[model samples]
Structures are given as structure tokens and as C-alpha cells.
Target chain A: MSHVYERVALIGLGLIAGSMGLAMKAHGLAGEVVGTARSKDTRDVAVGLGLCDRVTETAAEAAKDADLVVLAVPVGAMGAIAAEIAPHLKPGATVTDVGSVKKHVVEAVSPHLPDTVHFVPGHPLAGTEHSGPHAGFATLFENRWCLLITDAGCEAGAVANLRALWEGMGANVEEMDADHHDLVLAVTSHTPHLIAYTMVGVADDLRRVTDSEVIKYSAAGFRDFTRIAASDPTMWRDVFLTNKEATLEILGRFTEELFALQRAIRTGDGEQLFDYFTRTRAIRRGIIEAGQDTEAPDFGRGTSRK
Target chain B: MSHVYERVALIGLGLIAGSMGLAMKAHGLAGEVVGTARSKDTRDVAVGLGLCDRVTETAAEAAKDADLVVLAVPVGAMGAIAAEIAPHLKPGATVTDVGSVKKHVVEAVSPHLPDTVHFVPGHPLAGTEHSGPHAGFATLFENRWCLLITDAGCEAGAVANLRALWEGMGANVEEMDADHHDLVLAVTSHTPHLIAYTMVGVADDLRRVTDSEVIKYSAAGFRDFTRIAASDPTMWRDVFLTNKEATLEILGRFTEELFALQRAIRTGDGEQLFDYFTRTRAIRRGIIEAGQDTEAPDFGRGTSRK
Candidate 1:
């Protein structure tokens, strides 16, 4: 791969940004990579890990001469960072974000960016329970979908270039409207995460079952819930807050369906539970067929980890 | 390891039974293992896969002359199978089960067995989404928990021998009351599986998001739910039906907690969501520390499968 951006500035040094840094270096996707984090410890760690060619104390210093600036901070912090770096952005620079919620990020950061800079909101549908700079690896985004939100007046060339960079780093990019992206993500990611968090919370709060017992017997199904619930709390909190309507909507549907199933269980309606479980099995087949996950047993966790 | 039981009979050759067969064979925990399934096709598959030394046509035939009889059928089927095999069980032999729900199994199987036989109910806290004889592996129970239920009248020697067999097959054995085991499982497994099935059902029913989109973008979180929801419909349906009281209790608690979190999301209460998520992260840490799961990124799926 060749350089798609002469200088790339990463505004936040967390899992996503650190992953992008390592992936870019591995694939030679950028000529120079510069990064900044709010904490000195994070910046020092990034520098020590050689995640970027240069580590700056301020976002402004990192974005001063960058052709592509990535706002990889929490969704709530996008506006402040964008305002700080707006005046320092180079002419015709492209500013993209990797926030989970796209519309809120566009609303938060768009007004602060200069008109010369292209604001393209993006979200890479890839992550693990782990976070932080050390949690990233070179192939974090391999074969994962990166959804890009393009406004009507956004430059096609800018979008194309940004997509090329993500592709070079091993992601498949697709374009969607901001509202649709938020809604779709609420269905696919946000609500599911919230539900996982809630389930794990319920397990934790059960007084009848001891905590050690829950942990000991978790390998059956609750272990998966704990993994998702273990995700970065601040990032997920912002996700639910920023994507409130969509998350609530999906939650509403989830509650209704769950209530119906609960009724079935209470009523001893084996047919209803069987039909519902059988239908969901087909969706799992669809996911395996789409290559989003493995068909290997136990989510491939038992075989490999053991 | 030497043989703990001279002859072991596994009734209902599914994932758990088949796995027990393989693990027992691998560790030489039983002198001879015989299995029987309701379906001729299942028995044929067990024989073809070498999951057992002999595949019998009836539960009675499998139970005859067996020193250890394992009822590995679904909880709902235990009563009928027990009645069929009770007449054939050897004197002084130990009869146990691998049912997910134990209180019901004890009630169903204990009465049918003669006083000479020691009836011990058990539940192995291990399985994958896949089912059938083909899904069996020798290491499925390695490092996983197997809860054994022993009443006051149960023989200590019988319990100790059963524990030795499980330990020899690479499982950690624990003892708990039948009702407590059911309730704990309701919290750890049954309710989680039901919620996963409901979530996947909601995703499939959503009109706005295409099935392709859900499957393609599932890597974020929903993929885990799908893997869990893909579990055997018959087994899960039986679990929900047989363990109705405990499962419903957990479902009631789950719904209450979920509604609270849903309200928090609607009211823009980031603090509540953050606290709940943060607390749940501690449980995940406990599971990892308990060695029930790995802290490897992406559930260790990406590194091993890719």
C-alpha cells in the first residue's frame, strides 16, 4: 500500500486510534502519523510503543500540518477537540471521526470545523472487551465494516480518499446517511450492548446466588454477556446517551418481545418458546454465512482458549 | 487414569453425552461406555463417530449390567426414560443424570429407581451451541464446573466415585442442593439464553434493518447473542419448560432491571448506565480470574480462527 495521507493526526490515543496507528504502520497507509492524548501517561505510552511518528501534547499541535485528522475521542468530547484544532487544520484537510454514534458526532463537531476541511463521520464495527493503547493490534479492523456517513454537499474525492485509507488498513467501507447509521447501529450495536450490560447487572445483583457461583458457572451463556458488559464504560455510556432515541426504541421492542417470551415461560407454552428459539437459530446461520462470525462451536472460544 | 466404573451407560446421545463419551474414553475413566438415543440416525452417528463402544437400541438395553447409568436426555424426557430403564438397572449401581435442571430430574428419576440403586442428579456447566454426536470433543468439560446434587440418603461412596469420574475427565466438581442448583442456573444460564433468543428475534423482526445488514454488522455485539441463541431449540425449550419456576423468577428480575436501565436511557441518565456497566465489568474480571473465560481480545476468537 502507498500513502493516502501525507500526515495523519489522531486526536485520541485509545483502542481505536491506537489500532489505526499500528495498522497504518503495518500497511504503510500514511506517510507520517502524529497523535495526542489528554493524559501525559497515554501520550508517553503511545510514544514508547511507537504508535506514531510524533506524539504531541495538544490536538492543535498534532493537526497543524496534517492532511487527514481523525477525531477518535469519546463522542461527547468531539466538539471541544474539533474547536481546538479548527484553526490549525491545513487547507482542504479531511477531518473524520471514529465515534460509535454518527449523528451526535456530526452535530457536535461540524460547526467547529472550518469550511475548507471535509467532515466525514465514520464508525468501525470492530472492538473487543479490552480497551486502552496497549489493547490495540495491527489487524483489529481486518474484514470489519467501517460505516461512513456522508452529507449531501461533502466532497466525493475526500470521501474516496478516506475510504481508501481505511481499506488500506484492512476495513471494508460503506456509505450511509447519518440518521440511518445511528438507527441501524442502535439495532445492531447500541441496544445489544445496553441489554448485555443490564443482564450482567442483574446477575451481579442477585442475592440468592453468590458472586463466586455466578462466575464459576458462567461458561454456559452468561460469560458472553459479561464480555460485552466489560466494554469501556465511558464509551458505552456516551453511546446510550447520544443515541438515546434509537437505543430506547430498540429497547422498547426488546422489552415487548421479552415480555411475550416471559409470558410463554410462565404459561408453559413450549411451542412458543421452541418456535422463537428455532427462528433465532436461523439468524445465527445467516451471520455465519455472511462471515461476520465463525461457525466453530462455542463461538470458537472453548476450542482455542482451552 | 484407571477405570472408575466397570461399565457406563449414556442414555440420549447428544452433545453432552457424546462429549462425556469422548472425555471418558480419552482419560480411561470407564471400562466400557454404551449409549442410546431415541432416533436411529443419532445412534448411527454415535457409532460412526466412535463416541461409544456400543450403541444400544433401547434405554433398558443400555442400562442392563451397567455400573453407572447416565441419563443425558433433556429434562422433559428424563421421567419416561427413567421408567423404561429402572427395571434393568443393576443392583448397587449408581444412576446419575446430566440434565440442566436437577430438581425436576431428581423428582422424575429417583422414584423409578429401586432402593438398591444410588440416584445422584448432576448438571455439567459446559456445552457449545452445536449439538449432536458430531459436535462432541474430548476437552469440552476440561476446567468447567459440574454441579452434583446429593440428598441426605445418597451414599457418600457413590458421590465420591462420581466426582472422581468427572475429575478424571477434566472437570471441577461441586455439590449443591437441587433447588439451589436450579435457581443458580436460572440466573447464570436459563434466563441469559432466553434473553439472547429474544434479542435475536427482535433483530430479525425489525423492518427497518435488513437481515443482511444485521448479519454483516453483527461483529459489534449481536454476534455473541446470535451464537448463544443458536443453541439446540429442543434442549432450550425443555429447559424453559421444566425449569419454569426458577426461570420465570429470574426473568421477572431481569425485566425489572432492564426496565430500570431502559428508563435511565430514556431519561438521559448517563450516571446510572455508567455505574451499572462499571459494576458489571467487575463480574467479568471475576470470571476471567476464575479461569472460566479468557481475557484475550475478541473473546480469543480472532487470533485463533483467523
Candidate 2:
């Protein structure tokens, strides 16, 4: 509702950027939206989807005369995108990113920013297994968290302005140190994703190629893992590569914990298993009570309007 | 529905049996439906919810004149319940169970059945995280699979009649040997439930002692695991204990495959990780295409419906 920026340039037309376009439209918050993608096809598609007021083929072209620029590409691509758009960035333009791994993006992007330009790296804690321009919607950010990470010592006014912009999009903005952001995300997102990938991968290697069997019997518990494992491969690949240390660290802890549970199961320690399962149920209730998701059984399987 | 059983008795008041009661009522599939639970609280609730046409405090009282009896209890309690009700079962009553693990339940209850009885073990591969008599819905079995197992060579006509009852409830029924059903479910349901329980327990521990952050930022991916982890603790505890061997076997396969993927991530083998993630996506697509679930992201978070 407040005037935050005069012009906004989105430097990638993938899921995040595409979603940003829709969100900005919903709030009528941005002055002018310019979008760009590296590939010609994506550029054409972004324009065709009317994701922006004007579409360009290069980040430099999009950021020209822009008051704010958001990098919504993969973590590995943040630095180059920052560099490319740096030359054309308007003086005093505020730059932020929507990559999942914040520390990597901050470190990669902050150093290349001009002294006059503000670089505030952010990781919007929202996404879906879906990708591409068509997969986005104006409400993707509604009620989700947007974690902003930076050690750039940018102006408090700039950070507040960014916060207001996200709030307008219905996101709860939280400020966290970039490294801490990466560490938290490593456990919450990266490790869960790895586990899902592995389980589905294990099923894939079965000699029977029992695809229909797996699907038909998925209500048995395998379906949830499959949904997460179905996320964009390119996005996940970039995540693992860029956030390697934190991911490996959490995984190390996870493996140790997993082994102890395995030992209990092997030794027929039903009490231990029961206690843990009982304790885990409380957390699920907390999540549901927190209004992050549903409280219905099997998410109201028979009642869901799917 | 065919005149398969002159009367059928259901001995449980939870989601499985309650759904059976509602579905039978919906289709006029059963001749008479009598139900009971160990606790009078559940009996009162069952009667109030109309989950059974008649409710009794003891399983034997309900099964006294029934031509078919279904045991729908926690696997740990199956034997005791079967024993208490066995003497009262009508001559030639077909005895069956609706437990997730088939082998142990069949082993526990079938031996107690009278020579005049036909024992069949079955698992309806459909359920929600919710339980209790009030949680059941008439449409719960629609499009779901139900596996029936028997090594006793129960009459083909009896099996067909049983299959017809499930079909009337909107389930597709298949018959498999008890051991095979146990192994298949061990891999698909039991192991996955344990993994989810362990994962949620780890996060709960983290949230309590370390990261108040573990849950505040849960959606990064940890929340999906919580849904499975929220499942009935008593039920899952019994599953792991009763189906230990098969659960452990599938867990071993899962961890081995997981380690391979972990090594690939550590080595920056992007191609390997990408290939694995990509392959798993196909599996998810196959699941969706098979009509097991929707392609919607996290039950279509952005959409109004799941």
C-alpha cells in the first residue's frame, strides 16, 4: 500500500520470478515491471504471459532505469546475474534475490553491487514442486514466509521498504543472517528433499518396474514422499551444489538418528518406537494448529475437493 | 450385493471399521451389521455416530450370530480379541482382519478360528491420518485397493463374496498370499511410516532443544513428513513390531540407496543427482497418471481445492 519502488525489474522468468509478477499485479504495488530470461523462448513466453510491462532478453536490459531488481534464478546463477545487471542498474537501486540458499546468494551477489546500489539478499520461504511461467499465480506468496538475509549493512529504510513490499504480497517477512538461513533451510528443505529423492529412487530401481503397484498402494505412505521428490530437478540440483556443507552436516545428524531408530526396531524395542511415534505426533499437531496446514485426517481424503 | 453372508459383524470402532459400516450402509451390502469395541466409550460413540446398526460392549456378543466377522483392531490386540470372540462366532462364519500387516495378523488370529470357520486376512490399502469411529466417511474406499490374503484355501465362493462386499464399498480387491501382502506393505507402508516418525521426532527434538527455528520455518520441506508422522501411534507401533523383518528389509534397501545419493551429492556429481531427481519425477508422474493422486503441489496450496 505504501510507495516502495518506482520500477521493478525481475531478472529471471522461472517459477519465482513468474510468481513475483503475479503477486505484484495482485497488490498493484509496483510502478513498472520489466522481466528478462536468458533463453529466447522463456523471454517470449514471459511476454506472452504478460508477466511484465516490457520483456527483455537480458538482465542488463531489464534492470536499466529500474528502482528495484530481484534475482529469481538458481543459486548457482545469482552471481552472474548480479554481474550482468550491475552495469545497467540505476543508481541507488535496491537488489534482492529469491534463491532458496541465502548465504550463497548473499556472498555471490553482494560483492558485485555498486556502492550506490543496495544489495539485500532474500530467500522467499515459499515454492511448489511445479516450475515454469505457467506454474505461477498471484497468490503464491499469500501467508508464506519470506526470509531476508544480508550482512550488507544496507539502509534500515531500505530493509523496511522491502519488508513492506513483501507484506503487501501477504508474506510474513523475517530477517535472518544469511549463513543461519542456509543452515535452517538445509534441514527443513534440502534434507527432506534428499530423503524423498532417495526413497523414490530406490523404488525406481526395483526390477519389476512396479509403477502401477506403487501408485495404487501409495496411500500406504509412499505418496507423500513422491510429491516432494517430484520438485524441479534443476532447482534441486542447484540447491545441493551451492549449499553443500550445511546439507551434509544435517544429513550426518539425520543418519545417526536414523541408525538409532533402526537399532531400536531391530532389537524389538517397541516402547522406544511407541514413545518416539507419540512424541512426533505432537509436532504434527503443532504444525496444524499453527495454521500452516490442515488438521483433517489424511488431509480429509474423502472430503478434499480434488 | 449378493447374498454372500447372512450377517456380518465388525469388531472395532475406528476409521477402518467405521468406514466399513458406513459403506455397507451406503450400498445395503451387508445383511446385518453388529459392532463392538473393548471400551464402552467407543461403543457409545459408535452408536451415537451410527457407525453400526447395533453396538455391544464385547466382540463375542456382536459375533454370536454373524455369518462373517471382521477383526479391525491394533495388530497387537488382534490375538486377544480373536480369542475372546472365537467361541461365540456362528458355525461356518468367515473370519477376516483389516490390519496393515497380513502375515502376523493371520498367524495370530487364524489359528484360533474354529474348524468350521473360514479365515481370510485382508488390508484395505486406504486410510487417512485420522482415526476413531467419528472419522470414517462413506466414500473412504472409493478408488482404493484392498488386498485379501489366505493360505487356508478358503472356499472360492466365500472369497468372491468377500470381494463383492469390498466392491460394493468402491474398492478394487485382489487376493495374494499372506506373506506376499506382508512384504509388499512392509516396503510401501510400514517402513515409510517409521521413516516419517523418525524424521518428525528428529525435528521435534531439534525444535525443543536447539532450533526454535525447526518449526517456524517448517515448510522448506519438513512439514510433509509431519502428516505421515501424525498417524496413529499405537497402530504404527504395532505395525513395526509385528512386521519387523519386512520393515527392516525395506529400510536396509532404502538406506543403501540413500547413501549412494548422498555420496553423489558430496562429490558434486550434479549429473547423478539430476538424473536421480529426474527419474523420481517420472515415478511421481506415473503415480498421478495412474489416478492415485493429484499433480497439485502440496495438495494444491495456491488453489482453493486439493
Candidate 3:
């Protein structure tokens, strides 16, 4: 692979940014990778890990002269970081983001970016429960979807170049409208995460079952929820807060469906429950066929030890 | 390892019973293992896989002269199978089960058993989404819990022998009251399964996000739910039907807490969402510390292909 950008600045060196640094270096996709984080500890760790060619103390310093600038901070912090680095952005440079909530991120950061720079909001549809500078792996985005938002005013060449960078890093790239992306993610990621968090919370409050027992016997089904609920709280908080309408919309649908299923259980409607479960099983098959998940038993959880 | 029973019979050759057969044979825990399933296809598959030493046509024929009989069918079918096999049970034989809902199984199967036989209800808190005879593996129950309900009138030697057999199959055994076991499972397994099914169903029903998109982008949290939702529909249907009261109770609590979190989201209460999410993360850490799940990213989903 060859360099897609002369220099790339990654603001907020967390999992996505750190992984981008490692993956870009591994694939030789960027000429020079410069990164900055708000936390000294994160910056120190990134420097120690050699994640970036240059570790700067500020987003502005990192953005200076960079051909591509990635706002890899939490969604809530995107606007401030965008403003901080706006004046320093090189002319004709492309600025993108790795925020989970794309609509709010575009709303948050687009105004702060100069008209000379291409602002293409992007979200990589991949993550591990683990976070921080040390939690990233080079192959994290491999075979994952990275959706880019090409709102009006975004240059076609800049979007294509950004897409090539992500594809070179081993992601399948697609373009989506910012609002549609948020709604789709609300169904696919945000609402499910809230549900997982809520279920784990409910289990925690159940005194009769005991937390130790919940932990010990979690392999049955609840353990999957725990894995999801273990995601970064601050990141998820920003996700729900920023994508409020879509997340709540999906959650409301979830609750309505949940009540119907609860009534089925309460009324001993085996056929209703059976039909609903059977339909969901077909979706699982679709996912496996799509290569999004493994068909091995228990999501291959038993054998998934590193 | 010495034989725990001279002859063992497994009725309904599904995942659990088939696994028990393979595990027992692997450990030399039974002198002879016989199994029977309602479907001819299942029986043929069991014989083809060499899952049992003998494949019988009927539950009674499999139960005949066997020192241990395991009713491994769905919870709703336990009563009928018990009635069918009760007449042929050998004297002093230990009659056990591997049903998910114990109280209902005990209620359904106990009355049909003769007084000369010891009826000890057991539930192995382990399984995968896969079903049928071909889904069994020798290590399915390894390091998992198998709860035995030793109610009054159950012989101590029978309980011990059953526990020893499970131990031989690499399961940690525990004794609990049937009612408490049902309630605990409702909180841990049944309700979680229902929630997963409902979420998957809701995703399926969403018109805005095409099914292809949902499947393609499912890796972010939704894939886990799909795996859980892919569990055998008939078995889950029976689980909910049999364990109605407890499942409904947990679902009630789940909805109550979900509403609170929903309200927090609606009101932009980031603190409430953050604290709840943080508390749930501690539980996830506890589960990892207790060795119930992997702390690896994505539940080590990428590396677990073997």
C-alpha cells in the first residue's frame, strides 16, 4: 500500500485513533501520523507505544500542515476540538471524524471547520468493549464497515481519498447520509447497547439472585449483555445524549415489542413466542451468511480466548 | 475413570443429551449409553455420529434395564416422556433430567416416576445456540454449572451418583431447591433470552434500515443478541411457557428499569445514564474476574474460529 495522505493528524488518541495509527503504519497508508489527546496519561501511553510518528501537545499543533485531520474524540468533545484545530487546518486538507453518532458530530464540528478544508464525517462500525490508548489493535477495522457522510460542500476527491485510506486500512467503505446513519446505528448499536446496560443494571439490583451468582452463571445468556455493557461509559453517554431522538425512537419500539412478548409469556401464548423467536432466528442466519458473525456455537464464546 | 452407571439412557437426543453421551463416552463414565429421539432424523444422526452405543426407537425401550435415565427433551415434553418411560424404568434406577426450567420439570416428571426409582431433577447451566444431535461436543459442559434439585424423598446415593457423573463430564455440580433454581434462572437466562429475541425481532421489523444493512453492520453489539436469539425456538418457547411466573417478574423489573434509563435519556440526564452504565461495567468486570467471560475485545469473537 502507498500513502493516501502526506500527513494525517488524529485528535484524541483513543481506541479508534490509536488503531488507525497502528494500522496506517502497518499498511504504509499515511506518510506521517500525528496525534494528540486531552489526557497526559493517554498521550504518554501513545508516545510510549509509538502509535504516532509525532505526538503533539495540542490539536492545533497536530493539525498544522496535515493533509488529513481526524477528530477521534468522544462525540461530546468533537465541536471544541474542531474549533481548537480549525485555524491550523492546512488549505485543501480533508477533515473527518470517527464519532459513532454522525449527524450530531457533523452538526457539532462542521461549522468550526474552514470552507477550504473538506469535512467528510465518518464512522467505523467496529469497536471492542475495551477503550483507551492501549486497547487498540491494527486489525480492529479489518473486514468492518466504515460509513462516510458526504454532505453537500464535501469535495468528491477528498471523499474518495478518505475512502481509500480506510479501505487500505482493511475496512469496507460505504457512503451514507448523516441522519440515516444515526437511525440505522440507533437500531444496530445504540438501542442494543442501552438495552444491554439496562439488563445488567436490573441484574445488579436483584438482591435475591446475588451478584456473585449472576457473575458465576452468566455464561447462559447474560454474559453477552455484559460484554456489550462493558463498553466505555463516557463514549456511550455521549452517544445516547447526542443521538437522543433516534436512540429513544428505537428504545420506544423495543419497549413496545418487549411488552408484547411479556404479555405472551404472561398469557402462556406459546405460539406467539415461538413465532417471534423463529423469525429472529432467521435474522441470525442472515448475519452469519453476511459474514458479520460466526455460526459456531455460543458465538464461539467458549473458544474465544486470546 | 470408572463407570458411574452400568447403563445410561438419554431421551431426546438434542444438544444437551448428545453432549452428555459424548462426554460420558469420552470419560468412560458409563458402561453402555443408549439414546432415543422423537424424530427419526435425530436418531439417525445420533447413530451416524456414534453419539450412543445403542439407538432405541422409543423412550421406554431406551429406559429399559438402564441404571440411569436422562430426560433431555424440552420442558413441555418432559411430562409425556416421563409417562412413556415410567413403566419401563428399572428398579432403583436414578431418573434425572437436563431441563432449563427445573420446577416445571419436577412437577411434570415426578408424578410419573415409580417410587422404586429415584427422581432427581438437574439443569446444566450451559449450552450454545445450536441444537440437534450433531451440535454436541465432549467439552460442552466443561467448567460449566449443573444444578441438581434434590428434593425430599430423593435418595442421597442417587444424588451423589448423579453429581459424580456430571463431575466426570467436567461440570461443577451444585444442589438447589427447584423453585429457587427457576427464579434464579429466570433472572439470569430466561429473561435475557426473551430480551434478546425481542431486540432481534424489533430490528427485523424496522423498515428504514434494510435487513441487509442490519446484518452487514451487526458486529457492533447487535450480533451478540442475534446469537442468543438464534437459540432453538421450540426449547425457548417451552422455557418461557414453563417458567412463566418468574420470567414475567424479571421482565417487569427489566421494563421498570429500562423506562428509568429511557427517561434519563429523554431528559438529557447524562449523569444518570453514566452512573448506571458505570455500575453495570463493574458487574461485567466481576463476571470476567469470576472467570465466566473473556475480557478480550469483542468477546474474542475474531480469534475464536476453531
Candidate 4:
């Protein structure tokens, strides 16, 4: 593919930014990809791994003269990075973020960005449990949804260009309202992650069933929870803290539904449990049909794949 | 892998029993495998797939003259099947089961068995979301745990032979007390499945977030829960109904831990959230170290496999 941006600055060279760099380079979608991280070690690693064309010591240096700037830091850290790079961003440059919770990111970064630069918050709905520059792969965003907050009143050309960049990097781009995106993600990602973390914690705290046993026999089902719970703690912490209202609201609904299921088990209501479980199967089918997940058994773990 | 049993009878032609049939045949572990299912269509499928050497119309017919009779039906149906096959079971035959909840299976199946027969309940801690005879694979139990309840006072030879059969089918066998097995599974499998089902149900219930959006964007962690939730409804209902006390206990602890984390989010206690999440990561590492799950990203989905 041809270059979508003359230069792209990635602030916070973690999984998303690293993947962006690799994917952009693989597709020839950016003329130059400059990256910076809070830690010198991460920046050095990114540089060593060729995750960026060049490494910058500061977000300002990276943002300077870049046609596109991506804030890929923790949601809680977005505002500070935005402010640090605000003055350096080229005029008419498009600035977007790859944060899990978009409303919080928009609230955190938009005010800090100068009016000269167009701010369009974006979140790619794809990831592995692994993090860091080393964990990223060029195809990470392939066939994944990258939702852009076009309702933020950015110029049409800016939004379209940003969308093209994402699409060129192998993502399907769609525009979503920031608040709606947060709420939807709270239901889809945030709440599920918290539940996985909580379940893993409870298993660890259990003395009767030793941790070894939990680990050894995890293939029964619990292993899936651990995979999700194993995601980056700092990024997840920011997610829950910044997306508080929506996550808590979803969690409340989750607990209510959980209590009802618990009651069904306690009361020996087999039909209720059966019906509830059967209904949920349709959603799984929908996901498989949507090509979001594989239908292979056990997520095709240990299975031959091509 | 010489014949572990002269003739084996599988009393339910679902995933587990069908897998046992294929695995046994693949390893030459049984001279003949006869399978029976309640539905005629399932019996035909099992026979057509060569999951069994022969298909029997009734549990009694399959149990007759078999050296090992495996009660592989849903937990709730074990009692009825055991009672149905009790009269026809061969003298000195080993009666084992592959049920998730061991205590209930023991209670449901042991009473009807003749004193001449040995009752040993077993559970293979391996499966996929898929069900039915068609879902079975010869390697389904490879490197997975098969817990046997030898504490039920079955003959030593019978227990050893059962263990050998599971080993022949590529499972690592362990002896566990029936009650402890129930509790461990409650913490590991039953509760996780319930939570997943409930989360998926809640997502489906939300009218505001269209189902299409939820399905389309599910790869962001929600898809894992959907896979778990998509598991066979009838089997899960039976699991919860039979393992009620232990499941409820784990669910109680889970809710307690979840509430604490929820409070942390509400109060902006990032430290607690981060610490809890970090601690949970250790379990995932342990699972990987224990060889229970692959370290491949996203369970190695869409990746080339050797």
C-alpha cells in the first residue's frame, strides 16, 4: 500500500503502538514511524526491534512535524502526554488515541490538544494477553474493528484520513460516539476483564484447592479466565478507574444476573439454567459468524492450524 | 497400548464417550467398543464416525458382557442409566464414569451397581465448547487430567485398570476423593462456566447495545466468555444442579472478591486493582509453566501451526 501519512508519531511504544509501527511498515502505510516511551528500556527495546523507524526521547520530539500522532499510553496518562506534545504537533495534523475506554480518553486528551491539530479518538478492538513492544505482531489488527470517534467534530478530511490509515493497517474502521463506545466496551471488554481477574483472584485465595491443582487442571475451563486476567495490569487498572461508571453499571447488571443464576442452582431450577445457557449460545454463534472468533474447539488450542 | 479392556461399553455417545471410543480404537486399548445414546440419530452418528465398533439401542445391551462400562451421560441422567444397565452388567466388570461432578455421579451410579461389579467414578478435565459425537477427537484428552475417585472403595485392580485405560487414551490420571473433586471442580469449572453464561446473557439482554455490535466487537475479551458460554446447555445445567453446594460456595467467594475490586474502582484505588491484577498474572504463568495451556497469543488463533 502507499503511504497514508508523511510521518506518524507514536507516544508510548507498547503493544498497540508497536503493532501499529510494524503493521504500518509492513503495508508501507507511513513514510516514517517515530516512537517514544516513558521508560528508556522500552524505547531502546522498540528501537532494537525496529518497531519504529526512529526513537524519540520525548513525546514532543516525536510529535514534531508528524502528520499523525497516536497516544498509546494508559488512559490515565493520556492528558499529560497530550499536553507535553500539544505544542510540537504540526498544524492540521490528525491526533488519535488507541485507548480501551474512548470517552475517558477524549475527556483526558482533547482539551490538551491544540485547535490547530485535529483530535480524533480511536480504539482498536483487538489484542492478545501479551503486552510490550516485543509482543506485537504485524497482523495484530488485521480483520479487527478500529472504532474512531468522528462525533468529536473533527474536520471531515482529518477523520477520513485517519480512517484510511487504520484501514491500510488492516483494520475495519467505523465511527462511534465516544460515550457509546465506552458503554459498549464496558459490556464487551472492561466488565469481562474485571470478572476474569476477580475469579482468578478467588481461585488463588482458596486454600483447599491448592494453586498447583488450579493450574494443573485449568484446562477444564478456568484457563480461559487466566489468559484474560493475565493482561497488562497497569492498562487494565486505568481502564477500570477511568471507565468507572459504565463498568460498574455493567458489573451491577452482571451480579444481578449472576445472583439469579446462583438462585437457580440453589433452588435446583434446571430449566432456568438450561434456558439461560441455551440463549447465550446464540451470541457465540453470532460472534463466529461475524468472524470475530474461530469456531475451532477450545479456541483451537494444540490443534493444527494453517 | 494393548487392550486395556476386552470389551468397553460407553453409555452415552456425547463428546467424552465418543472421544473415549476414538482414542481407545486409535490406541488398540479396547478389543471392542459398544456405544449407546438416548437419541437414535446420535447412535447413527457414532456408528458412522466409527466412534464405536458397534452401536447399541439401549444402555443394558451395551453394558452386557462388557469388561468396562463407562457412564458418560449427563450427570442428572446417570442414576437412571446406572439403574437401567445394573442388571445386565458383566460380573467383575469395572463401572466408571466421565462426569464433571464426581460426588454426585458416585451417589447417582453406585447404588444400582451389583456387588460383583466395581464402581469407580472418573472425570476427564478436558473438553471444548462443541458437543455431540461429531465433536470427539482422538487427542481430546492428550496431556489433560483424568481424575478417578478411588476412595469410593473400588477394587485396587479395577482402579488401576481404569487409570491405565485413561493413560492409554493419553490422559494423566490422578486419584481424588469424590467430595474434594466436586469442590475443586466447583472452583475451577462450574463457577467459571456460570459466570461466562451470565455475562453473555447480560450482553444479549442489553437492548441499547445492539447484538450485532457486541458480536462484531467481541474479540476484545468478550469472545472468550462467549466460547465458554456456548458450551452444551443441558450438560452445564446438570453440572450446576448436581454440584450445587460447592458451586454456590465458590460463587459466593467470587462475588465477595468482585465487590472488593468494584469498590476499588469506585474509590479510584488503582493500587488495589493493579496489585490484584498482577497477582492473578502469576496463576496464568503457573498454568503455562504446568503445560496446561499454550503460550501462543490468543490461544494461537489464525496462526500457522506445525
TM-score of chain B of each: 0.96, 0.95, 0.97, 0.97
Query: Looking at candidate 1, what TM-score does chain B attain?
Result: 0.96
Write the residue-wise lDDT of candidate 3 on A1-306 in tens digits: 779998999898889999999999989999999999997899999989878987899999999999999999889999999999999889999999999999898888988888889898999998899899998778988899999998666788999999999999889999989988998899899999999998898899873456478777888898889889999999999999999999988998999999898888888999999999989988888888889887778767673211
User: Mind giving the per-residue lDDT tens digits that candidate 2 earns over A155-258?
Assistant: 88779888888988889998879788888888778988999888787666651644356666777788888888999998899999989998988788788888
> Per-candidate DockQ versus the true complex?
0.69, 0.62, 0.65, 0.70
TM-score per model over all chains: 0.97, 0.96, 0.98, 0.98
lDDT of 4: 0.90
Residue-level lDDT tens digits of model 1 in B1-306: 789999999999988999999889989999999999999999999999888999999999999999999999888999999999999989999999999998889888888989989998888898999998888888998888889998788899999999999999788999989999998899889999998999899999873456478778888899999999999999999999889999988888888888898888889989998898888998899889988888887777763322
Q: Retained native contacts per candidate, as fractions? A: 0.80, 0.66, 0.78, 0.81
Query: B149-227 in candidate 3: lDDT tens per residue?
Result: 9867678999999999999998999898998888888878999999999999999998345647887888888989999
Tell me what TM-score chain A of model 4 achieves.
0.97
* List of clashing residue pairs for candidate 3: none
lDDT for A282 in candidate 1 is: 89
Tens digits of per-residue lDDT for model 4 on B1-306? 579999999999989998889889989999999999999999999999999999989999999999999989889999999999999988999999988898888888888989999998899998899999898989988878899888646689999899999999888999879888888888789999999999999999883456478878888899999999999999999999999999999999999999999999999999999999999999999889988889988888863322
Error of 2 at B112 (Å): 1.2
> Candidate 1, what DockQ?
0.69
- Superposed on all Cα atoms, the candidates' RMSDs to the truth, in angstroms, are 1.6, 2.0, 1.8, 1.6
